[model samples]
Target: MTTAREVLDRCDALAACSDAPERLDRAHLTPALARAHGLVAGWMAEAGLRTWRDQAGNLCGRTEGREPGLPALLLGSHLDTVPDAGRYDGMLGVLLGIAVAQRLRDEVPTWPCALEVVGFTDEEGARFGTALMGSRALAGTWDDAWWDLRDASGTTVAQAARDFGLDPGLVGTAARRPQDLVAYLEAHIEQGPLLEAADRSLGVVTTIAGARRFLVEVVGEARHAGGTPYPRRRDALVGAAEAIVLVERTVRGSDAIATVGRIEVEPGAVNVIPGRAVFTVDLRAATDDARDAMRDTLLAGIAQVCAARGLGMRVTDLYEAPATPCADRLRDALRAGVVATGDAAPLDVWSRAGHDGMAVSAVTDVGMLFVRCHDGISHHPAEAVREVDVAAALDAFTAAVRTVGATAGSGATVRSGATVGSGA
Candidate 1:
């Protein structure tokens, strides 16, 4: 069997040869991104697997099993990276799937179900303003409304798809039928420091956190800074600052988190009193109720602050994604995989910062295995994961595939509450 180091070496080689860089400033996929996709396709072909592109531009590679009648086990993750993202973020999952298929072909010989690996496209939402575009298409969630979205250069998604040799009209064909897949698995870098901080090798995600994003606007009269006394002036920026503090207080009071990540003030002359201010509020929680409560609290707090400052406040919800629980059967299998290697530790817990696995889990029984990332920093140039941790994650994922493959069609329903073992 090829060692994890050998697999990672291959991944590193691809990273170097591809146009994908650690930053997004001048990054363009026009030519180099295509080359990277071709490299992955070539690798899949060399592994003796059949490869093809879906309507949404996802690259799929398949390994048939002894019993071809059973629904296949799907392993997938996007190959595209965020602007200035580390090479490992989404690439590891796709390459690891290939590695697992190679291992199965050499050792197991025959299995009950087939194994399919997919490299999803445009998952970062960096250039197109839409995340999970490929997966959503496969889930039959992509709609016509998004077709006209233009990038910084005013190029539409449809136009970009055509430029890349993909037919926009056929994108809907990417959705998989219910009978075609049994379950899905994804191996990814934790993109956080929790695992490393706890000295663990892997993380079996239990649930993906639900998220709510809002835009808050505070309106007040513009006045000269020198002419307006503290009591006489209704400063919109001041009201916005108070609302930000109130949002923090409300979230801290409940089991939720709210962040004021972006803020803007209009009429930028420093000497004049600002007439209006805008800010974004991002809230996340483990459950839908908690998230909703956080939103309500933010709304109330903003209103109260606006009334107190004699300003008008408006809140608009931009987006909301509900929490998605991981598959019970797959969770148990992941636990068993950890125990099988004897390196398993007590399970550590975490909620996703953004949505990816949740999008897949909504449509299928999906599982995720996380490798510890350095300092819990991601979507930046310094994002990293340790080599040993990566190997451990591969081992756990392999065990999971074996467990799921072995019991594909016995009509044996795996309960959601099954436990694997302790965390590292």
Candidate 2:
């Protein structure tokens, strides 16, 4: 079998200058990410796999098995990254799939099913404001509404699709029939410090956290900061401060988490009292019920703070995705794989910040494996993962692949269909 270090090295070489702003900004499949996609496709073809681009621009490489009609096992992760994102985020999964293909190249005959490695486009949503665009299409979840989504330059997703040589009208062809895919698995970095703090080598995610987003706007009368008496001032910033505290309290009261990630004040001048404030609230929990409770608590707290401050407020939901449970069989397979390597560590715990696996889980039996990242920092240029730990994760993943491949139709893929999108 190919080593994890080798796999990682290959991916690094391919994406060495990808999406680098100086080389054609990689965000939103800008020319840079598209070039990276082309490079990956070239590598896949060289590896002796049949490669093609789906209607949604998902680059797929297939390794055929003895049974052409059997459902294929899908391995995927997005290739696009946030602005200046680290290389390992989505590239590792695709490279690992390539390693799997290399392993089977000269092996004996009679494979049970096919292997498909997909490099999904636009998972970061950094530029487009819509995450998992590629996976959503594969899951048959994208609609015309997404066509209107524009980036900072007012470039629509539809326009981007055309710019990259993909047919915008054929986007629906990316969706697969249930019978076409047996299961899906993704390997990614933990993107957090939990695994490193726990001294673990692998993290078999139990549930991808449920998330709810809200845009809060607070309005108040503007006044001159120097001319207006402090008592007479109607400051939106002051009201926003109170709302932030309430948001903290609301999340702290339950087993949920919340953050006011972005905030803006109108007439942002030191000499003027703020007239309005806008902020986004991101809340996450292990279940929909917990998430709903947290949302309600936050809303009530915001209303109370607004009423006390005599400020007008409005709350709008951007989007909400319920919690998704990882497949039990797949989880067990991963555990076994880790144990087989003799470096198996106890399962690490943490909520995922963002991942494409969440979207795939909505439609099929999907599992995730996370390798510990250095200092738990991600979405930055300095993000790093230990090479040795990554190798261990690869071993664990390879074992899981073998187990799933060997036990193709033993009901493992069937028992967990309900858990894919079930919030529990």
Best by lDDT: 2
* Candidate models: Cα lDDT each: 0.76, 0.78
Q: Native-vs-model 2 lDDT?
A: 0.78
Q: What is the C-alpha RMSD of each candidate to the true structure, in Å?
A: 4.1, 3.1
Tens digits of per-residue lDDT for model 1 on 1-424? Answer: 6568876886676566444454432122345556667888987887667899887878898877775555578887777776666767778888888888777765333766678888887777777787888788887788778789888899988888888888999987888654566678888888777788888878887767789899999999999999889999889998999999988877887767789999999887899999999999988887888889778867987898899889998878899998877777888888888777676564745565654566665456777777788888877767777778777777788889988876775544222221221111
Error of 2 at 173 (Å): 1.7
Error of 1 at 104 (Å): 1.2
Q: What count of clashes does model 2 give?
A: 1
- In TM-score terms, candidate 2 sits at 0.91
How far residue 126's Cα lies from its native spot in candidate 1, in Å, is 0.9
